[model samples]
Target chain A: MKTLYVQGNTWLHRLSPGLKLGGLAVFSLLLFATRSPVVLAAAVFLAGAIHASMRFGVVRTWQQLRVILLSISILTVFTLLLNGPADALAVFLRLVALAVLAATITATTSTAEFIDTITAGARPLERIGLVKAADLGLAIGLVVRFVPEVLARYEAIRDAHRARGLKQRPLTLAVPLIIQTLRHADEIAAAIDARGIRGQNNRKLGEGS
Target chain B: MATRDLVLAALFAAIIVALGLVPPIMLGFIPVPITAQSLGVMLAGVILGAKRGGLAVLLVLVLVAIGLPVLSGGRGGLATFVLPTAGYLVGWFFAAVAIGYCSERFVGRSQSALVQVTGFFMAAMIGGVVILHGLGILWLAYGTGTGLSTAFLGDLAFIPGDILKAAIAALAGRAVMVGYPLLPQRA
Candidate 1:
């Protein structure tokens, strides 16, 4: 999964990923714990201001959140019909605040920095033999890199389905997509084997110390 | 834990993330849209078995924890875990494990192709749909302050599409079992 990271020299960009993630966690917890519309609206205002402080202004941020807004609208309308406008407004504000805050962090933090922080965070888990920190880092990198590739393959399969004058049947689309994906996995497995990047082997090598 | 296993886990996780890129099939009647990502959960379980499949999903959840836009409609981050739909997201991990465990039991000894396919479909439905939706409804109720019955009724619209996903997962599972049996064999 590619992050929404864009290069910028703002202070938010300069902040450590750990701090950013930690702050996001604390802020989100507070948002969920409270139900007061006044409190929630204030939180939303603060979040929006923080987002504006980033290089990407409110307009672009709102543009990127079009899908989220749509989803929120659905929930908002449901709340409106079921509960009342008051409940709907509260839900809408809460969702918008949380989503924008998250998108801002992703937009500011580079992927490499994010992965580095994750690897550093995982180092403590190695004591319990949960996972090799380095292996976890590499695996995450592989996942991030591979998501777009698989999406591309999905597009290719969909186009082929279209070319065949087939109705966009989910079943037909899924079978080929899975087949192509596993085939690609086979190739990736072979490459990992060839590169000698085995996790167990690496653990063995580390144990020699 | 071998290189190949690690690669397989990562690859399947990527497939899960990739599935999220598909535009969700929105039904006007349902609050929750039909997303392709859940199918990846079924596929992982059917193809990779319990241990690796569970790990594959866990890996994706970790990515989500750190705020990657990996969920359908580009939703992610720690906040999402506290949202109403959070149960479905959390359910993915356990559902993969359940599907994988049941797939082994259901399909492990079946000789007839029909039985095997049925087993696959049943396993996917039991784990991927029933369990996931059950948890999803509970969370939706709590999140929205709605009654449990209301939430359960609200989720009924998902049944038809979810059954289709199960069928597709079953067919795909059978095809992989025959054409490319790379999954680790477990008792």
Candidate 2:
């Protein structure tokens, strides 16, 4: 998974990822805690201010927000039709507030910082043997590594099909795709095991420390 | 989990993200589009079984949480979780689990082609369509204050499309089973 984090020296960028994320959680709760349009309007104003302060420029900011704002607009329209104007305004303000704030956090935090934060959070789960933090981190790493490779393979397969003069469909393309990926996965698992990169082998390797 | 399971699950998660490359079919009535990614969830379920399939979806959600544009239409981040249609997105994991568990139980290695296809179809419809929609519609209604009737009506537009997706996923699941066979040997 690729993050669209812009390089910045802003105050939010200086803040730790965990704090930004924690604040996002708390702020979301508070936003939903109210049905008051005035409060939510204030929240939206504050969130928009923060977004503008990030200095992503108007086009960059709109590019970040346009997709979500589209959904928010539709949601507002539906709420207006179903629940009346008062409810619609509240919904609109609340969503805009949440979207901008979340986008701000996302834009500010780099991918490495986000992963480190997530891995730190996963540590507690690891301590309980629910998962090893290393393994969980590796899984996320593998996903990021694999997405582009899979997409590239997909285009190659599509090209192959075109060369063969076969019409492409989801099932036909997907079968080969899954088979190819699973084969790669098997080889990857073997490579990881051979390198003692997981489970007890790695644990024992670090045992002397 | 074994390293192999972890790797397999991660790879499937990537596949789910890759599915987002397909342009979504936007319905004029609903905020979200009819996405191929949901079919990826079903495929993972049917191909990997419950545990791994569910993990694959969970990992995808983690990517979304980290602000990756992994969802159809490249939508993601914390706000995506709170959208009116987000219930459907969240439902993907449970729906995969439902489909996986049912397909594992209903399909057998020695089963006739007809029986296997039938089993997969039923699994996808019951789990992918029914279970996903039940959770999704309720969330859209209660969580978003859309009113149950309004939410239900809005969801009806997608049911046919979802059913079609289930059919496609079912067929793909069967094909993968024949080609690769992964659920307890996917028997």
Candidate 3:
């Protein structure tokens, strides 16, 4: 989904997806473990600095963050109401910092890099018959391709409902949506079957047995 | 796994992400928006069964971890795992398994349509509402530094919407059962 990825060729874009993901994990863990507002504030500034260094322009970064920023803002009000200004401020800073830092990585890395890295990383588990790297990669690729298509279908369905002057009842929307999506899945499964992909898996298992 | 299973898992993973694009129905009481993605979780379980269903959700989580904005409200990345919603996200995997296991156990091929629908509804409620909310509230409290009781109190607002989702999941599950009968017939 383009909503998920922002294309760019900064220094951050050059790093391997594995390295980028690992670093993001460590950074998030540290943020979660630290409760201090000062540390979180500094983290926010550091995250911002990293984004600025990319020269990706603040506008695009903000564009990627519009929904998240609104969410954090709404959450800030709740935290303020439930806890206090100190907690609210800390929560806001932490969320903003993490979201921005994450946006930086997503903006830089390509989806292909992500899938390849995941497949490579999981290749080690093949020893136990628990991993099939190629299949895993293909599955991830299919998911990426289908998400937007499904979303478009959802819009079409919703439009149809609206045309009929149906109330925005979730039940009505969900029933048709679920049926259509599952039908699509069934077709894909049938297509795979026709392609003889499952034949390979069956033969491999037969040989192993 | 069969190639069909792999394709179904990926397809359901896409379904989960697609559900996130549905604009959340807000009730104004809770901070969390009423999103349709959770229904996708239930459907995955009901349609795919336990092992395949869990893998389907795990696939989505993997995509999210790699920084795809597949989550509701368009939020994703490693950062989401640290947020107050992290528990629900993590729970999605187990919830799928739990619901699928329950559905498979309680709703057999010989069962009547009414019984099958009831079974699906029960499975959805147990896993999607109870298990998911249990994990979600715990994480929300831990992440936000709120007391467990308070966090749970806040989560109460979601019950009404979640009940509706369970009902919808049940209806859809029954429809799939009649229309496609994807579950393998008894040996």
**Interface RMSD per candidate (angstroms):** 4.8, 4.7, 4.0
> Against the true two-chain complex, what DockQ does each candidate achieve?
0.42, 0.47, 0.46
Of models 1 and 2, which has the larger DockQ? 2
| Alpha-carbon RMSD, candidate 1 | 4.2
lDDT of 2 by residue, B1-187 (tens): 7777778899999999998876654444545655668889988888888888889998999888777888887787777876667789889989999998988888888998888888988888988889999999998886567778888888898898778778778888888888875423431
**Mind giving the per-residue lDDT tens digits that candidate 2 earns over A1-209?**
45668888999999999999899889888987899988999999999999999889999888888999998899899889889998899888988998899898988988778889988898999888787777767888899999999898888888898999986677777888888987776578777877877856553433322
lDDT tens digits, residue span B1-187, model 3: 6665676788789988988878875433445556888888998888777878888999999888777878877777665665676788899998998988888887876888889899999998998899989998998888777679878988898877888788878888777767666544211
- Candidate 3 colliding pairs: none
Q: How far out, in Å, is residue B173 in model 2? A: 0.9
**TM-scores for every predicted model:** 0.84, 0.91, 0.85
Chain A TM-score, candidate 1? 0.79
lDDT of each: 0.78, 0.83, 0.78
What is the Cα-based TM-score of model 2?
Answer: 0.91
Query: What order do you get sorting by TM-score, best first?
Result: 2, 3, 1
Q: Model 2: runs farther than 4 Å from truth?
A: A201-209, B24-34, B182-187
Could you give candidate 1's per-residue lDDT for residues B114-170 as a string of tens digits? 988998898899888988899899888777666688778788977788887888789
Question: In candidate 1, residue B135 scores what lDDT?
Answer: 88
